[model samples]
Target: MSLYSRKAARLQLNLRKVAVKGGLAIGAAQAANAALQAAFIVILARLLSPADFGLTAMVFPIVFFVTMLQEGGLTSAVIQRETISHRELSSLFWINAAIGLALALLLCAGAPLVATFYHEPRVEGLTMASGGLVLLGALAVQHLALLNRNMHYGRMAFIDVTAAFVGFIVAIAVAAAYHSYWAIWLRGFVTIAMTFVLAWLLSGWTPGRLAPVSQIRDLIGFGGNMTAFSLCNYASRNLDNVLIGKFSGEVSLGLYDRAYRIVTLPLLLINAPLNRIITPVLSRTRDQEERYRNAFLSTLQMGLLVTVPLMSFIAGNSKGVILLLLGPDWIDAAPICAWLSVATLLQLAGNPMGWLYISQGRSRDLMLAGVANSMFICLAFVAGLPWGALGVAKAYAFCAFLSTPLLFWWATRRGPVSLRNLVGAISPFALVAGCCLVVVHLLQRSRPDTGLLFLMELLTASYATMVLTLSVTRTGRSCLAQAWSVAVSGFSMMQMRKRSSYG
Candidate 1:
C-alpha cells in the first residue's frame, strides 16, 4: 500500500483496538455495577416498605432535573470539541460550579413544594438530602469529560466501579443500622461525592486562571442546546412518576418504579458504557465517512446483540424475574415489567443515534428530536394515567414502539447514518432474538410455573438457542469470533501487567 493508505489502515486498526479494549473495560465495570445495584435493591427492598421506595422515587425526577441544569451539557461540549484551551476549561468549570451551587440551593428551597405535591412530608427531607449531588456532579463533569475525550475508559471504569462499590457498602451498612429511607438518600450522596473525589484525583488536571470569557460563548451555546434537549428528555421520561405519585399514590408508584428498574437494568449496563466509548470515538472519526459509518453500525450491532436477547428474555420471563428479585409484594409490577421490557427493547435499538447527532454537531436536530419525542411520551403518559400504573406502562410501551421508526428517520435523515443502514445492521440480531423470544415465551407458557428452576430453565434454553442459531450463520460466527478475540486479548493484557508489576 502507498504511505497514505498504510497510514489509514494503521489508524483503522488502532481504532478497532481502542474500541475493543474500551468495550471490555467498560463492560466489566458496568457488570460489576449492575451486580452491586441488584444486590442493593434486593437488600433494600426487603428492609424498606414500598411506600419508602415510592417516597424516594418521587424525589429522583427533581434531583435529575437539577442535575441536568448543573452540568448543562458542557461536558458533552468539551468532549465533542476537537480543540479546547485551559481558559475555556476553567471558565466552564467555574460556570458549572456556580450552576451546581445555585441548583443545589434551589432544590433545598423547593423541597417543601415537592412534599406538598406528593402529599408526603418525607419527600421534603429526601429532596433536600439529595440536593448535594448537584454540586458534586457538577464538580466531576469536566474531569469525566476530559477522561472520555482522551479515551481513558479503563481509568474511568475504575473510578466508576470503585465509587459504586464504596457507595454500596455505605448504603448497605446504613440500611442495616437505620432501616429507613435515609439509606437510599445517603447512597446517592455518598456515590456522587466519591465519584467527584476520585475523578479529580485521577484526571490530574487543575483549572488555571480564568481568561477572557468571550472564548467560551460558542461552547456555552452548544451546551445550552444539549441541556435543553436533556431537560425535555428528562421530563418525558419522569412525568410518569410525577403523575403516578400525584394520582395513584406512593404504593402504586413504588411498584411501578421497581418494575421499571428491573426492565431497564440491562439497558443501563449496556448503553451507558458504550455511549461513553462511542461518543468520543465517533467524534474523533467524523471526518472519515466510511469509517464513521462502519464503526457506528458495528457498535449498534453489538448493542442489539446484547440488548435484544436480554430484553426478550426479560419480557418472556418478567413474572418470574420480578417475583424472584423483588418478592411477592411486587407481583403487580410483573406485567408492567414485561411490557416495559418490550418497550426498552424497541427503544434501545435506536439509542445509538445520539452519537451521530452529537458527534456531527447536529445539536439542533437533536434538540428538535428530543422535543418531538418528549411530547409523544408525555401524551402517552397522560393517556394512560386514568388507568393507573399498568395502563401508563402499556401506553408508554405502545407509543415507544410506534414512534421508534420515526425517531430513527429523524436521527439519521441528516447524518452519515441512515434508516436503511440501521435496519441492515440490526436486522440479523433482531431476527435471532425474536426467534429466541418466541421459544422462551412458549416454554414459559407451557410450564406455567414461576420458580427459580423454571426461570433458570427458560434462560438457559433461550441463551442456548440464541447461541446455536448465531453459530450457524456466517455473520453471527464472525461476531462471536471478534468478541472472543477481544476477550482473550484483554485477559492476556491484564495477566501481563500483573506479571510486570510483580517482577
Candidate 2:
C-alpha cells in the first residue's frame, strides 16, 4: 500500500482502539455513578418529603445555568482547537475563574428574589448554598477539558465516580441527621468541590502567566458563542421546572423533577459518555469527512443500542420502576415518568446533531438552533402550565416528539452529516425498540401486579425480546458483532496492561 493508504489504515485502527477503551472506561464509570445515584435517590426519597426535593430542584437550574457561564464553553473550545498554547489556556482559566466568582456573588444576591418568585422561603437558602458550585466548577472546567482533549477517559471516569460516591455518602449522612432539603444542597456542593480538587490533581497542568488578551481572542470568541448556546439551551430545558414550580407548588414540581430524572437516567449513563468521547474523536477527523461521518454514526448506533431498549423498558414499566426505586410515596411520578421516557428517547435520538455542529466548527449554527429550541420549549411549557406538572410533562414530551425531525434536518442541513444518513442509521434501532416496547407493554398488562417478582419478569422479558429480535435480523446481527468486537478488544487491552504491569 502507498504511504497515504498505510497512514489511513493506521488512523482507522487507532480510532477503533480509542473507541473501545473510551467506551469501557465510561461504561464502568456510568454504571458506578448510576448505582450511587440510585442509592441516593432511594434513600433520599424515603427520608425527605417531595417538597424538599422540589425546593432543591427549583434552585438547580439557576445554579447550573450560572455554572455553564463559568465553563463559558472554553473547555469545548480547548478540545476543538487543533492546537492550543499554555498562555491561551491560562487566559481561559483566569477568565473562567472570574466568571465563576461573579456568578456566585450574583446568585447569592438574587437568592431572595428566587424565593419570592417561588413563594417559598426555603428557596432563598437553597439558592445561596448552591451558588458556590459555579466557582468550584470554574476551578475544574479547564482541567476536565484538558483531560477530555487528551482522551484520558479512565482517569476522568475515576474522578467522576469517586466524587459522586463521596458526595452521596455525605448527603445520606446529612439527610439522616437533619431530615431536610439541606442534605440535597450539600450533596451538590460536595460533589462539585470534590470534582474540582480531583480534576486539578489528574489534569497535571498548572496555569502560568496569562496570555495577552489579544492572543486568545479567537478562543474566547469561540467560547462566547458556545456559552450563548448553553444559556439558551439551559433556559429551554429548565423552563419547565421554573414554570411548574411557580404554578403547581413544590409537591407537583417534585413529582415532575423525580419523573424527569428517572426517565433520563439511561441517557445520562450512555449518551452523555458517548458525546464526551465523540467530540474529541470527531475533531481529530474533521478533515476526513467519510471517517468523521462513519465514526459519529457508529457511536450513535451503539449508544442507541443500549439506550433504546432501556428507555422502552422504562416507558413500558414506569409505574413499577418508580414503585421499586422511589417507593410508594413517589408512585404519582409514574405517569410523568412514562411521558418523559418518550421525550428522552426522542431527545437522545436527535442528540448527535450536536456532535456534528461542534466538531465541524459550527457554533453559530448551534447557537441559532439553541435559540429556536428554547423558543419552542418555552411555548410548550407555558401552554402546559395551567394544568400543573402533568400538563407540563405531556406538553414537553409532545414538543420534543414534534421537533425531532425538524431538529435533524436543521442540524444536518449544513454539516457533512445528512438527514438521510441520520434516519437510515437510527431506523433499525427505532423499529426494534418499538417492537420491544409493544411486547413489553403487553406483558406488563398481563402481569398488572407491581410486585418485585413480576417487575423483574417484565424487565427480563423486555430485554430478552430485544436481544432475540436483534440476533434474528441482519442489521441487528451487525450491531451485535460490532459491539462484541469492541468488548473483546477492550478485554484484551486490559489483559495486556495487567501482564505488562506484573512483568
State the lDDT of candidate 2 residue by residue for 1-503, as single tens digits.
Answer: 99997998898888778878888898899999988888888889999999998989889889878888889988878999999988888888888888889988999999999988888888898788766787899988889999999899999999989999889999999999989899998888898899999999999999888988888888888898899999999988898988888888889989999888888788889888998899999998888878888888888888887788788888888998999989999989999998888888888888778898889888888898888988998999899888888888889889998888888988899766788988877777777678878987999888688888887787777777777878866777887888777778889999998999999
For model 1, residues 260-338, the per-residue Cα lDDT tens digits are 9888888889998989988888888898888889888877767776777778888988888988899988888899898
Candidate 1 residue 104 C-alpha distance from true site, Å:
0.9
Candidate lDDT (C-alpha), each: 0.86, 0.87
Worst 10 residues of 2 by lDDT: 458-467
Q: Provide the lowest-lDDT 10-residue window in model 1.
A: 478-487
Candidate 2: deviation at residue 248, Å? 0.8
- Candidate 1: RMSD to truth: 1.8
What residue pairs are clashing in model 1? Answer: none
Kindly report which residue pairs in candidate 2 clash with one another.
none
Backbone clash numbers for all candidates listed = 0, 0
| TM, every model | 0.96, 0.97
